[model samples]
Target: MIRGQCLITNKDDQYNDPDVAVILGSDKNPTCESQSVLMAPKIKLSSGYDMPILGFGTYNLNGYQCLTAIHSAVESGYRHFDTAFNHENERQIGEALRTQIQMGNVSRENIFLTTKLWNIHHDPRDVRRICEHQLNLLGFEYIDLYLMQFPVGYRHMCDEILTPINDISVLTTDVDYVDTWRAMEELVKLGLVRSIGLSNFNMEQIQRIIQCSSSKPVVNQIEIWPGFMQKDLVDYCRYNGIVVTAFAPLGQPNREKHTPIYFFSEGMKRLVKKYKRSAAQIVLRYLVDYGVIPIPKAGNPLHIKENLKIFDFKLEEIDIRALRGIKSKERLVQYENIKNHKFYPFERED
Candidate 1:
């Protein structure tokens, strides 16, 4: 059974170091920042599990880099990890986590690990097979949370081919997501996963699932940042008791020529100076305060430590108002390839 209580700390007890020098020191002495790093508080999921509000995202990380980043994140006091089978790094993640467990750094019970079921495996028959394969890759008894990767389904060419395509576009399957959700609920009953949820699914899709399934989704993972808050959808999910996990919470500032305007806006600059925090830190804190878990991916050691420090401070109401008022309505992660599918969640862009 997954068990734990939320670790509530006073706002004044937050670590105040702006440089994060203590947490970024040499790995030889791992205990240097043990007491300095503030552990993130946990939010109870409807599935009866406690998930840390700030999670580590492993989307593009692979091989040695992936392993090293996980170690760094663990050292920086991160307890929640987000990955997908399509991310293609579960094997390395499992190895890194197993190493940590062997070294007595963290236990399985305390770590909240979340992975997704790929669209190709949406057929109810293939769901269990793919989940078990993922377990073998992860080398875990059961997953903490397993999310339906998207509302749409894709053709199953083979186990290795994640995105099977043809001359027309990506080949989509006729499998209904409700059927996929039913198969996922079976996973919970069979002890393959502790909790089940949805990802990249819009409000209408989520409503359909709620109407049909006996086990309601505890989470809806999606893209959320200052630029595109998806207010109505977020409000709908919250009203239905579904927790939102924000991916790309920093707005992918590294994207060439497409840097999020908020990153350089004078308003954001003022808030950064006022709080003595980085732009990334301010946005992350704002999202958390806005009531969602932000899983920002960082391979750099300094960034890993910096991301974890947001738990120490609370964003003021006026600052929150300023952030919410940002007018840019750009959505960063549009899965354009599958947009033509009948169940494509987002509105078709011209």
Candidate 2:
């Protein structure tokens, strides 16, 4: 039997609960092989909502591919779905989610749905409109969590004018993130969302938001992987009562030139043999051990199942220490296009 302690955050920002523990075993584990991975525990957010420590990410996936992957993910026992308006796959995810709910696979209440407010709509007047547009696309009553996709605000109103790449035509907006955050806070008040959070924001930016907004950001979704540990920022978020969710946990294997699978070196081979798990699983377990939620995007059903199987085992603290020793601070998802924007995050370190 493997014993693991669940981390619960109280109002004071403490992440400990010695009184609560879970054992991974046959009787306690569900019979279905896929459902067995649902044993992954939930972490309570400051918003009083519990989110699964592991979430299925929907990025760079579109149309039928995204729909199929989401449907497969739910069948594989994933309860959390992470998407963004910028991802352009929300409609597909929404359709898949609705279909699953109708088919009795999972309910909206049980799934943690997250979407972001694109930077184009950062203007206070545009926030609600973009959010409502996403709502209509999602076909949902209320979003579980809404986040600002990036700190840099853009002035483009039409989708055709906005492009992911840097274009002189796409101008930066004068609207501040503080104003956007406050508008996001209104989302909670209007019952349009359960919680509001941040994504792609750095430490100083997060501090400014906290100081200026009425509602504290419940989470910060950033690029985190075995190679890019981001210890300082992760520490700051944890200490400040914000849950950190790691995207690109497997090092974006497809984008090897930009985000190489550095965790698959000779040093990791021993752990792979010891745990009998994939390199991706080991990397994910490392984040979970540090109380950081990891949202790994996997299109293959086997990979999805393997990713969720991390809960069945716990790494020794010594091993975790060694894993942390592998240091490379390369950020994979840095928006180089908007790096020069005044509100651009990652311009400074913690």
Candidate 3:
């Protein structure tokens, strides 16, 4: 096993970094200050911690690829990271951060790392143990944001704790999400985590957590894009002082195979030509204008830089409206297997 801060991976397997440094602002954009690099802007959470408006999402990234992506994100000036225990890459993410610190590329204090408690580990008695296990895997003292990945709680098998199985037959715990939230509140008091939040929860679930907990969830990470805006949920979270985070910010990458192309809507194309930015950047900026943080994942050097460039440009009010006009019923990341679970949150017809 890799010990301390050292990474255990083959040198030949390392991800390629082009070593090209783009200033925060290109000369063509006179409105941008050329002196500053294009790092993501931070927004203050209800918990009083500052979270970057854009973060690198480490979902489905693993092993050397995970390490490489993490390194590239840090090198590209990304300070916030979003990962989950269920993603199964916390060790690689942690190793990458430790490697970068060792190389003087970045420091721990400067990075905002987030991970979640898996549904199986939501048992109140096992919450601390789960958090400690994540800390050990991450090799960090405290996680910046710790979230309950889902409202569904399962009875974790002792033998399967180390190797989590994804079968529905595994019985669920007698625990409820509110009890889990109470236990999560204790995690904050213990100094193991800086902030606590929810993911994949609907309005009622979030409200329940808010009402029951001593420490409120500062942010809610959900699947949001132009098509499946979840406008009502977003508005509710805003009205309630909870920040909204968009996962799959660019829509599901492979969605084109099953759905019609919505990326290049006539309105989006117009904005792309007017602003000289990618369609992806325009959509991300759209969410940002609505006070939502988008965590778009990418490992390529150019793609990573392109995703960060959204902050340098502002979409006019007219353009924002035009882009928001595009509509469809495309909701990705639906956990249909657990829809019957008592805590499943997407049941509302609204």
Note each model's CA RMSD in angstroms. 5.5, 5.5, 9.2
Candidate 2 lowest-lDDT run of ten: 1-10
Worst window of 10 by summed lDDT in candidate 3: 1-10
Clashes of each: 0, 0, 3
Model 1 pairs whose backbones collide: none
lDDT of 2 by residue, 273-340 (tens): 99898888988988888778999998888888788888657788888988887778667777766666
Clashes of 2: 0
Residues 1-350 of candidate 1 have per-residue lDDT tens digits of 11222233333443332211122221223442243445676777888788888899999999999999999888667878999999999999989987877776667887789999999999999999999999999999999999998989999999788889898599998799999999999999999999999999998899999999898999999999897888888899899989999999988885466478878888888999999999999999999878889999999999998988986677888999999988867687788998878899999978
My TM-score estimates for the predictions, one after another, are: 0.90, 0.87, 0.85
- Clash pairs, candidate 3, are 24-38, 155-172, 155-173
The residue pairs in collision within model 2 are none
Cα error, residue 135 of model 2, in Å, equals 0.8
* Model 3 agreement with the true structure over 277-302: per-residue lDDT tens digits: 98878888888877799999887768
Lowest-sum lDDT 10-residue window in model 1: 18-27
Model 3: residue 65 alpha-carbon error in angstroms: 1.4
Assess the local accuracy of residue 175 in candidate 2 as a C-alpha lDDT between 0 and 100: 89
TM-score of 2: 0.87
